[model samples]
Target chain A: MPRQIRRWGPPLLLISPSLIIIGVFVYGLIAININTSMTDIHTAAQATGRKPSEFVGLVNYTDLLASPAFQHSLRNLVLYTVVFLVGTMVMGFVWAWLLDRPARGEGIFRSVYLFPMAVSFIASGVVWRWLLNSNQGENASGLNRLFQILGVPFLQNNWWNNVNYGIAAIAIPAIWQLSGYVMALFLAGFRGIPEELREAGRIDGASEWKLYRYVLFPQLSPVALSAVVIIGHMSLKAFDLIMSISKPANYQTKVPAVDMYVFKSAFNYADAAAVGVILLVIVAILIVPYLVHTARAEKS
Target chain B: MRRMAAVAAVAAVTLGLAACSSGGDDEATSTSTGTEAGSGGDVEVFTWWAAGSEKLGLDALVGVFETQHPEYTFVNGAVAGGAGSAAKDLLQSRLQANDPPDTFQAHAGKELTDYIDAGQLEDVSALYDDYDLTDVFPPTLLDLLTVDGMIYSIPSNIHRSNMVWANPAVLTEAGLDPAATYDSIEAWFPALDAVQATGKTALSVATTWTQVNLLETILMSDLGPESYNGLWDGTTDWSSTEVTAALTDFEKLMSYTNTDRDGLDWPEATQLVIDGGAAFNVMGDWAVAAFEEQDKVAGTDYIYFPVPGSADLFGFLADSFTLPVGAPNPDGAKAWLDTVGSLEGQTAFNQAKGSIPARTDADPADFSEYQQSAIKAYAQDTIVPSLAHGAAASITVLTAISDATSKFTTGASDLATYQSELAAAAGS
Candidate 1:
């Protein structure tokens, strides 16, 4: 064998299994979901050999578009995505910057920030629900308990009813769970910058702000993009937190995943599938371009 | 390297073939033995009761089944999603993969109808015949389990869905009679409201299926059972004034429920009534099992009645198990089904489940007072087909109602919109 070919062959062979695993588990499932969405197959129908394999030509899509629940969920998903993306990225970057500075108990602070992410979403959701329970009026769950203990009665009202503040209430858990991941990503990106680059900028009369704006910010793009993509995906598929917060009776907490579940249970699998397909499409539209670009960048 | 690649490809092909063969064997093993193979002779029964006293009732049932079939064990596939959302989908995917449990719980009627039609269910009609189920089983229970005149499942018990469970203490505190007919239940709503004013929940409607159940009760009681049954199997105008009135009344009733009720499961709502946390809980007869767990005696601690002030029509459905086509132990499954369906089995299972036996011959004395009352309604022919919600329509139709109801109760949608959406779903 030629030397160049011989050198790369073993590495390629070694990685093949992992590639196959990814192909079957990740990409394959996505393809299956997409294909199923094109048909009208539901749990019952699928059970009965009545699975609609023939193409219905976007009937499901049209139905989805006309669904008010779907529309509301889409709006919620977009709002969640934007809030989650902005909150995590900005807060995470800020925390990352703060942690990057020399300080006491940096390790403890880092661990504190990262601890929320370490816990399972299920556990986090339960804890958050207990903390956010509306019954805890002035002394009940969430900020109320904290406020009431401080003799601040005004802070104890139903936070869920305040449309203006409810999104923020819901967002708190998302940020709590996600900012750490973002911070970690940003930390890695920040640390990648050579100390000499900062020193050179400093020696050239660049202030701290200016050094970051031009040098640091641009270098963090890839990391921020990565964070945005991941957090956005997580936010889009967010189920547990919203469910924990929003009782079915409260019009405030209804999200797409909850609705998907209700629809699925009610045996409205078509509607559920439609919701799922729309979610999948939304995520793909959000992330695929970045993924392709990243892959191309890596290849080059 | 090319040779190695070729060898690796061969290995892949071989392993793939092996996987396919193993899967085929696994399926054969499961399918051939039928229902006998429940989670490795440890029948992993999947249910939605993980809270409070339903858990106790389940424990009792498990104990009975275990004692009856010691060779078979039980695995708790008890998932905790209210309304059986997660577990049902999981069951569906498993059944689709032809890896269904030897036995799993199902609501008798259209829920199992799809499985029956798919030939995924073993008929077990002969088991019913052998069990001499006619004596103990009522025609209504049989009606729910039979599709195309063939019984596809064996119901463990009958749950009278129209029962309005009331706290006698709360009722007396409000100076209201607990034994009032369905029509009287609404009159008692003011009394319930009084209870609510006392800083307790007046009505424990969980604002999901419970709300739907309450609505069904109103329809059955006020609109008359004939018209209610017409809504399901017969032609009735859904937009009629009766439905409109029933829905409006239901809306008003919902106003009395706990603001946090939407997140509450039915059992939690029942717990409220049992704990004197709520005045009334309109749930199924099986709900008595919850109160019983607190050692509260029926007809004493709580008063059960049909939707009060309305007709005496009883709305009922059955909880049944279907033997999946590929159950690993079909013989054991058949044995399980035969044992469960027999007059003796029905008596034993129903007694534990706080449900009336599916068979007509199962001693009425074997049930609790609430169940005895339900059986009386059935005996008097007051028990109508429950198709209005549970038994009335196919699962597809029931789901449509549930979804529309969920949205409607949440105030995300309203009545006219609900009706139209329901119509669309039914037509779909």
Candidate 2:
């Protein structure tokens, strides 16, 4: 081999297996899925030997967009994303703020707050499903029962079972399962801020609130952005959490991922592929700008 | 760790070689044994009966299979889901991958047609003759199982979909008779009003599928069984006044249902009736199993009757097993099917599942009173297929209808819009 080729061959060979893995599983499958989405292959006639194939470009997308179920799912996704993102970030920041102060049993309280993060979303969903059981009156149990026992019947709402705000209720378990992780992220960001920055702010007659507002909060913007991106994608691709929490045919908590699952379960390959593509677009819409900004920031 | 890595490298290569060699053996075995040979003496029966009475029925059936074929071991590949959604999802993926089980549970009629059309299932038609099932099994059910003049599957049990279960105590509490049957759905409004007056939920409906269940029953109540059956075969018109009236009746019925019905499943709704939180629950006979789980006495605690004006109709969904074409063991699969269709097997399974046996001559003494009534209904009543459970319509049509109904129940779509959507779904 020539010297230049020989020098690069070993390094290239070292990464080839990983590159091939990503090539087939990531890009290759994505290409196949996109092609399938462009076709009219569904579970019934197409699955049977009847209609072999028909390439109907963008028809599935058009039909899906016009679909009432898909539109409702989109609404649910938007509502869930807003509630989950805001709930997790606010609760995480507040917990981090509380824990940032020095105390004797600070480690215990921190671990207590972070304990929920250790549980999987599926497990959290199962436990929360019971607590938020919507049955009222004579059959009421779970949180409603507790509310009744506490003589605070006003606090007992139907929770996630309410059609108007049920999708937002799905965000509760998502926020509970993830807020601790976000708190950990914020805690690390808080600890990473230089001690002299806070001292300099104090010397300049800045209050404790002003010090955090000017010095700490500005530095945590990147942390907050990363949290948003992470939770945003999770909320976008929310399937197992939603499915595990409610009945599959529930209209209120119908996210795009669950809609994709309904199509997939019926073997509507083309429509399922369309839902997948839409989700990819949503996640891309959410994350691509953040990625570009970070890339540019890193270069600068 | 290095040794383990070397072992893994060797294992990966072996697995790769094994996969490459499997296709050749499949063809070879097809000529001899008529199926791709399964590894060892294993017969994996795939199903969605992974919990509760369904699992109980499955286990009892598998026990019979194991007893009949002592030399072969059985693999109960039961995925968990009440409506078989998870199991069907898994089955489709395995079918696409060409890695099918020895036998898999599938709904009879249009649901099994998907596999039959795909050439994924074997013709077990001859087995019906061998087992003397030609005379014993109901001809309508056999016809439903047949496609292109070949029977592709064997039915184990038949479940009725149009039954209204009532808590007898709740009925009395609402100042209604336990044995009273409304001549028509429109007449139930008075009883519902009475229940509502008593401060209990008048009706208990749950989820979108349950709404679809009610819709199907209302459609039957309005169109009658004959015209309703015609809906699936392109004979009945979707835009007819009968369908319009059915939708109107279904809408009126929905007003009596608990507002929190969206989050509950069929079982939970049944529990509402049982707990006296609701006066009436419209569901499949599977609710009997749930009531039995709570040790509720059928005659005293709860009672079930046919949906109004559909007393002579059995809205049926049969759970059957198909012999996948590339199943590892054709012989083992045949043995399993024999157990599935046999008198002893159906008795054992249905006795637990709360559904009646598929056989015309199944012993009524082997079943509970509720199941015995269902068996009598199956024997005498005209049998129509369930739309929501992949029997009357194609799975695609059923899914679309489900989506439309889901939207409709939430008041996101109007009756006329849903009717049009239903037409589109049927035509597609």
Candidate 3:
């Protein structure tokens, strides 16, 4: 036992700092959050340690599940996720395909496309708030003004202000902000592909379109999966963008994260924590599969 | 020899990191202790008046605090946001951690009840007696401040939330009289229709809270001040025909508002009125400062009035300061509260804030024309709490109502659903 301790002690000590930090900050907090979610604590006094909170079992969770606001937020999340995922992937793939070949000012175009990623979601949301202004007629502004100037007034429509699918419109800005990042990922994937594969496809009498459809597209699956996961988790956790554009109370753009914020600000900690737990479970469901797949891939 | 050296290196790095973290903790402790050691200490007054006209109001108030309490250093702990939402969140966390600030701003009605019930605020009834504020503040205002004969906060200023700001130019273009007073909200609808006929928005509303503000005024109009106040206390039924009529009026008024109402803030909606894009906006008296910022004269450029049927009623919300139960500097906090409730402090703050002083004795000559009218009206008017401004309800109820209103305004929910949701919120 002493010999084993001597052999393992140095390495264990080396990693102990990081392990301890993550244990306390990450897992410990999550455990506390879950515990809080199951309690009946909703006041600042209880939250701050002035008053004791009672264990209420799943009451908060049941309440949230029955809430119309929470239900609507979940629906909004599904719509936002679908649009954000599809929009970013398609736009990113197209941009990468266009830029795959060597061209004049390639560096400038690449820089211009990636520049938006440098701005924070809050900052971009502020600009996009104006850009997506839904007012028409004499009060036409933002994108509506642009469409009018371009003589494409038919395209003028209420962007995020449209009640039926306003959350989908919010995804437009998310796509605008993140599609460039997806493009960067796809571009790297394209560049990493061996030229010999294309040469081999050419020798097989494959057309350029056919060559990409069979060879290039298959090779880019990993990149696409990664982009989806990254953007998927972001959309699930989206708060600042929606807040900066619309408000937390706005049903048009509100999601579970925004609802969590509203609950938190209202000092309904149990409800907020319940919403948080739901969001965490959702993100975990999306991520755990990818993590397992990656683990399997590494083992092989 | 090599293995020993590696082990030594790892131990040294870990120890260094531990030392660095401990060093940070020590520095933090030392600074905090240093601040607490002084005779007067630091009085950190937490508020959301961090920018624009609100910031100026706070600054003027701070100037009075400094002059009144020269021994203590005034720490401006202002967090900028609309309606103190962001600041309140931070304040809650601090209160939870038992690290309350010396004093914080709170709205003056049922909103303070939350803090009082939580045992987070100190009862300032003694301060009221000591300062002789009972005689100075209006009885109505004092009654609103009191809960079970105990007051937790001192009123700084009063903001009338039922005021209608109309652009004279827009009304003239729409061929309607801007200065014309309507007996009820229904009486105002014809004026709204006339404005809409001219291809302009009749009522310029913004976001969820402003809609609630409008709803409160309409309720006050339809149900009368007594019934409207009863709605908060469970004395009036939310499902009653009177409330249904109020909701119908609210829905009708919504039709005349700007299409992109949710996309704009209160200032932007108010700006539409100033720029002749809309006929009128129902906002708090703070909009007067906003108009003055744009160099627009009241009465000439824009006219003010009570929202039609709510005349002779002051739908009000007051900004007040509280001494937390476990404040770091209680003596300094009481001094700050004394300054906040003082005649001089109210004058300086209200003049800059474009709000009327909570003190009835404040000279009207020190205020603008709009404030002068408000002061006169406030004396004679039946006082009612403003719902949107955190006076009539707790934050949780307000948030729930806001969520329902947002859905209703966005057409996600109908009036019936909204009424049920509001009833459910109140019941909760």
> Which residue pairs of candidate 2 clash?
B38-B328
Chain A TM-score of candidate 3 vs. true chain A: 0.96
True contacts kept of each: 0.25, 0.42, 0.62
lDDT string, candidate 3, B156-274, tens digits: 99999998999999888888776688999989988999999999889999999899998888888889988998999999999898899999999999999998888888999999988
| Cα shift from native, residue B30, model 1 (Å) | 10
The predicted structure with the larger DockQ, 2 or 3, is 3
By summed lDDT, which 10 consecutive residues of candidate 3 chain A come out lowest? A19-28
- Decide which is better by DockQ, 1 or 2: 2
Query: Who is ahead in DockQ, 1 or 3?
Result: 3
Give the winner by lDDT.
Answer: 3
Q: Is candidate 1 or candidate 2 better by TM-score?
A: 2
Model 2: per-residue Cα lDDT at residue B34: 49
Off by over 4 Å in 3: A49-52, B1-39
lDDT of 3 at B6: 52
Q: Which ten residues in a row have the lowest lDDT in candidate 1 chain A?
A: A159-168
Cα displacement (angstroms), candidate 1, residue B18, comes to 13
Name the better of 1 and 2 by lDDT: 2
